[model samples]
Target: MRSSLIIIGFFASGVVLGLSGKLPNGFDFDKFGSYALYLLMFLAGLSIGSDKNSWSVLATHNYKIIWVPVTIIIGTLTGSALVSLILPSLTMKESMAVGAGFGYYSLSSVFITQLHSHSLGVTALLSNIFREVFTLLATPILVSYFGNLAGIASGGATAMDTTLPVISKYSGKSYAIIAVFSGIVLTILVPFLVTFILS
Candidate 1:
């Protein structure tokens, strides 16, 4: 919770700073942002790779565990399709592209902005942010009603980080491995899926 709060606070600070238009004149956010994202992704990969427990959990679990991330992908995209019907303005592909973010807002929004319109990029950012916030707030209720896997699903890509603590608290430590695995798979797929759909 404290970590989540700190992250949110930093994000809020950035927003305020950006909106203030007081940044240094020579700062090249566009050029630097992509490099920063690459570094972040590399660090995330290192974190996962260095975790011995995460690997052991995979080795112990049934091979069928692969289905978990697949189920999440299907369900998320299906829900996005339904939402597209209501939205009317966004096509099915566009909605699914946004949904493909799976709570990894930073990369998704940046990728979408580069591939598509700025408007769609904003939609992806907001949608993924909402996903993370909702998962954080509702994981306990979701776990109680729908089970641990539901909590993982609700977390999307954040199952590996931001929402992982909430999921671990409500679901169980054993399930942390599953969350990490699911998050890694979804995180890897987001950029490819979103780019493919947009293309």
Candidate 2:
């Protein structure tokens, strides 16, 4: 929760700076953002590699384990597709592309801006951010009504990082393992799926 607030603060600060023209005119956010996205993806993979539990889970070759991510992808895309019916501003593909972010806003927003429009990129950024924030704020209610795994599902890629602690506290250590696994899978798929959908 604190972390989310801090991130929002930083984002708002950046917005204020940009609006106030405090940044240098020659700064190339596009190039810097590209490199940062690559670095973030590398770090995500590195973290997954370092987690022995995740590897152990993968090593078992349990087909059922994949259902978590599979279901999440299906659910997110389906919901996004539904949303597109009402929001004429977004095409079906664009909506699904945004959903493919799975709460990994940084990479998704960058890819979206590069592939489409800056407005849609900002939409993806805020949409994914709200997805994560909703998970963090509503974990207890989600767990109470929807079950433990629902918290993990709500968290998306954040299940491994920002939302993990709340999920762990509410869902227990066992479900925490599943959260890590789910987060790892979603984090890895975000870029590829978003790009594929947009392309």
Candidate 3:
């Protein structure tokens, strides 16, 4: 909870700084943002790599566990498709494209903006942000009712980072490797799936 609070604080501070428009000249926030994201990804990879248990856990788990990520993909796309039916303004493909973000809001929103429009990009951003928040808030309850796997599924791609703490807390330490693996797989699929559906 403390870590989550710190993260929220940093995010709020960044928003304030950006909105204040008092940043030093030539600061190049965009470039800095990209570098920061790259660094985050690198650190995530480093942590996973350094943890020998992650690999061994996967090795011990049955290969059928692959269904976890597959289920997440199907569920997200299907939910988006259902929503598109209610929202006539967005085509099935466009809605699926947004859903493909799978909680990786930053990269997914940027990708959608480049492929489609700023409006759709904003939608993707908000949708993925909601997914992450909802996952974080609901994982414990979901775990109680549906078990650890369901909690991990709720996290989508964020299982590797932002939502990982909540997932680990509620789902048990044994599931952490699964959460990271599921997150990595979903994260890799997000861009391809979004682009493919959009195209």
**Best TM-score goes to which candidate?**
2
Which residue pairs overlap in candidate 2's backbone?
Answer: none
lDDT of 1 at 44: 67
Q: What is the lDDT of candidate 1?
A: 0.85
Off by over 4 Å in 3: 1-61
Q: After superposition, how far is residue 146 of candidate 3 from its true place, in Å?
A: 1.9
Model 3 lDDT per residue over 1-199, tens place: 3554565576569779979988888976556656775676576567667877557645656776788899999999999989899898999999999999998887788678777886898799778888898998899899999988987888899998889988889888889878988887788677779889999
lDDT of 2 by residue, 1-199 (tens): 6765776787789889999988888999888877876787788678768978766766657687689888999999999999999997889999999888898877788778877888888898899999988998999999999888898889898888889999999999988878888888898788789889988
Scanning candidate 2 in windows of ten residues, the lowest lDDT window is: 53-62
Report lDDT per candidate.
0.85, 0.85, 0.82
Candidate 2 accuracy as lDDT: 0.85
- The residue ranges of model 2 lying beyond 4 angstroms of the native Cα positions read 22-28, 31-54
Q: Which 10 consecutive positions of candidate 3 have the poorest summed lDDT?
A: 1-10
User: Please, what are the lDDT tens digits per residue for candidate 1 over residues 1-199?
Assistant: 4654665687679889989998999998767877876786687678668978557655655776788889999999999988899997999999999999999887788788767877898898888889999999999899989988988998899898889988899999988878988987788788788878888
- Which whole-number lDDT from 0 to 100 does residue 137 have in model 3? 89
Better of 1 and 3 by lDDT: 1
TM-score of each: 0.76, 0.83, 0.73
Whole-model lDDT, model 3: 0.82
Ranking by TM-score: 2, 1, 3
